[model samples]
Target chain A: MTSPARQLRGKDERAPVALSDRAMDNLRFIRETMERSASFTHVSGIGGVAMGLVAVAAAWAASRTTSDGAWLSIWLGAAGASFALSAFLMGRKSRAEGVALLSGPGRRFAWSMTPALAAGGVLTAALARGGHFGLLPGTWLLLYGASIVTGGSHSVRPVPVMGMAFMLAGVAALASPPAWGDAYMAAAFGGLHVVFGLLIWRKHGG
Target chain B: MAASSGAVRRRSLEPAERAPGNLDAVHGRTQESGPLELDQLIHERVRLGIVSALAVNGSLTFTDLRDLLGTTDGNLSAHARRLEDAGYVACKKSFDGRTPRTEYGLTEVGKRALNAYLDHMEAIIDATRE
Candidate 1:
């Protein structure tokens, strides 16, 4: 059995390990709560840059095409490539950050963004079939922006702002002459992506 | 007959004696009564951090928890083991290709305990303010 003096000394030794005051504990609790509930922080800046480059390339390729069919095909191909690149880069970044690909925030972002993308796909096919190709750029930008804004609500702050920018570009593309469609696409997708991607990269780290 | 009667009396009296202690245990403060009995297991900073993180993420790998909690491998392992032993957390071992990976998630008991702990702390804060 321990002596009373030894027990008293033991208690004294252990005193420092005790929980901190109420304020500190509350602060810690609040912080942990936020960390748990917040969206995944692994949105890939490099992925955005890659997507931007691909958009620039697609714009260049589409501009060289004389027929509407060829232009549509080129842009569609670019879309597929962008999707693949984004998935690959996001996967890499998520792994590096130890965030699951299907984490709560990730799932939320996908769910919110997927509908807009799906709508864009349907609208693209319909617009192309109807020979309303001039409106295609504006439609794509608007829908893509909508998706981003909706989805980015669940992502980091800049994402939604980028989405809003895309939406505005879509409106301008619609107001401009049909001849300016591809230029608008190039500007919004290529320019905005590179700019925002750089910002996210610099501010949020890789 | 007398001996059996005394045993029954003690058994009946046990709960009455234990009732106030239980209240003290839940409140985790004893200035007005006896001593507070906070769950010492989770009161420690590192252990609480680990548990709190797990409570939110649903599951986390050993490396994930280590990075999140900023703890060394050995320290995390020891605390995780203690929580595991208490049935407050569950651990699963698997392989990612050739590499072995260990993942942890809070068990039901842990979730309930964490909720109770939070509520108790809030109560303490409320009482102190009052």
Candidate 2:
């Protein structure tokens, strides 16, 4: 009911500021800074599950192919699709959290993962060029695991663990016969993704 | 002229003696209320920002702290120096390749002080609600 000018004069007559307002301002400042400094841990669980499903399908389709070229084509298609899906879902999650998809911790996460993924890409091309088709699964799993471990360092707990699981599967694939390659891909990419995806969803709110 | 000069000296000394401009002032301000004392050192805007950031991030480079707080080099250094002098923060000087890096972190004393400060603020909010 007080006039604006009267309220201003009344406030001036009192202490320079109210303690409650000052405290509230300080708390808000602290919260915003903490949020800014936090790592981007919103790697999507649903996205991971979806990627797993796609990988499973790719493995099935690949197993039925007559030529090595056809097998590679199926997997490459799945990788592309999975990457797109994960990126889209991650972007959505970032938006929901009111965080930028490409700034701060998100940028750090991407930077950490880049080298391993780049290595994977180059190795994939070189191995394929050499007609080293049997080595593809182990190489893919190992390098992809390396990428996850590095990137997931900036994400949640299960992410790096998932990467380690992939690395273990890669070691197994490398030690086992080439005939077991598809199975290792299925277990590592499909199974690992689904299991850890569920964990991340439950723990991190999907 | 001697009396006038003496008066000026006394006047300057009065403010310094009365204010003291540190923990004593903080104590005097809070003496009015029994439970409303705040750590004036950390109550400052920029210093509070520095402490809060370090509390969350564990450690931050000087550049990171400055950029995060949107403060200048001189301002940040001054405030950070105050915190370090109080034993509330620690500073490490290192080199990244050829570039010099200064990292700052909240010490144990600082963490406890921040916790106390937070508790005091929450108490104020709660008391006001009543």
Candidate 3:
């Protein structure tokens, strides 16, 4: 079916000089160029899968730890390691693709995502200070998901979808018993990452 | 000359439908033309593409812009030179090792022009829909 714009264009032979179908075409071209420029296209799919693997390992290690401190330490270490690995991989991919890592859309993406992550850091300290160990996983997932959702607005399509999945898992973790926290982390961080990572890899390329 | 001026005034006042071919009749020559009239400079396809792409990007290398637009080197060069001359675009030339790199960016004047152009197009769409 022809669009409303097309219909409008077709309705008038008398109005050809101004406000023609050519104007619509120009608008479409400009809109498309802006959208492409705004999209953060440097997300590393392989990095995502590798991060998931690290999360899975961290979850296993956390489960084996008898003390809450040790569990937190294990997960924190994993988080840092995962971040470094993802940064390295994403940088490599961006270089290979000839897209600057910290310019244009990438800069916008980082700006959008930074606030939630900063809040997460602040809240993590606050919660741990209060001995609220069980709440950590839920808080982490929720904030991380929020970051992804906000930043993913400037990223490829699937990034936001993955953010939504993380959010659902966060909600589930919050509702379930504290003993089930690690499992939820496994499912959301590990499983979702691998699934979406593979999909992004195949679709957007590694 | 007096009779000719009178005829021109009369034609300008005539209904737009009666003078479809006459732009000056439908949208008369004025100190400030409304949004229905498109900016002639950015109206062309290739030039419009260059401006639109530069609007969102911080800067783009000549090679990058050519690849993005899918245009040949000479064609891109000619259009880019036009924009550069219009003060709507800025060009920077530098060397990356042995290779010389030419980068292009949109100027502030260009940004305002593009914004005005976009406003005009949007106004057209809104008018059409109505």
* Stretch of 10 with least lDDT, candidate 3 chain B: B1-10
Model 1 has an lDDT value of 0.76
For candidate 1, what is the TM-score? 0.57
lDDT of 1 by residue, B65-119 (tens): 7877788999999999999999999999999999999999989998887776676
* Highest-DockQ candidate: 2
Off by over 4 Å in 3: A1-36, B1-41, B44-130
Interface quality of candidate 1 as DockQ: 0.03
Q: What TM-score does chain A of model 2 get?
A: 0.82
Q: List TM-scores of chain B, every candidate.
A: 0.73, 0.73, 0.73
CA-lDDT, candidates in order: 0.76, 0.79, 0.78
Best by lDDT: 2
lDDT of 3 by residue, A16-131 (tens): 42443545777989987765555687788998899899999999999999998999999899999999998898899899988789866888888998999999999999999999
Candidate scoring better on lDDT of 1 and 3: 3
Total clashing pairs in model 2 = 0
Give the C-alpha miss distance for residue B123 in model 1, angstroms.
20
Q: Kindly list the per-residue Cα lDDT of model 2 for residues A59-141, writing each as its tens digit.
A: 98898888999999999999999999999999999899887898767888899999998998999899999999899999999
Query: Against the true structure, what is each candidate's TM-score?
Result: 0.57, 0.58, 0.56
Residue B99 accuracy (lDDT) in model 1: 100
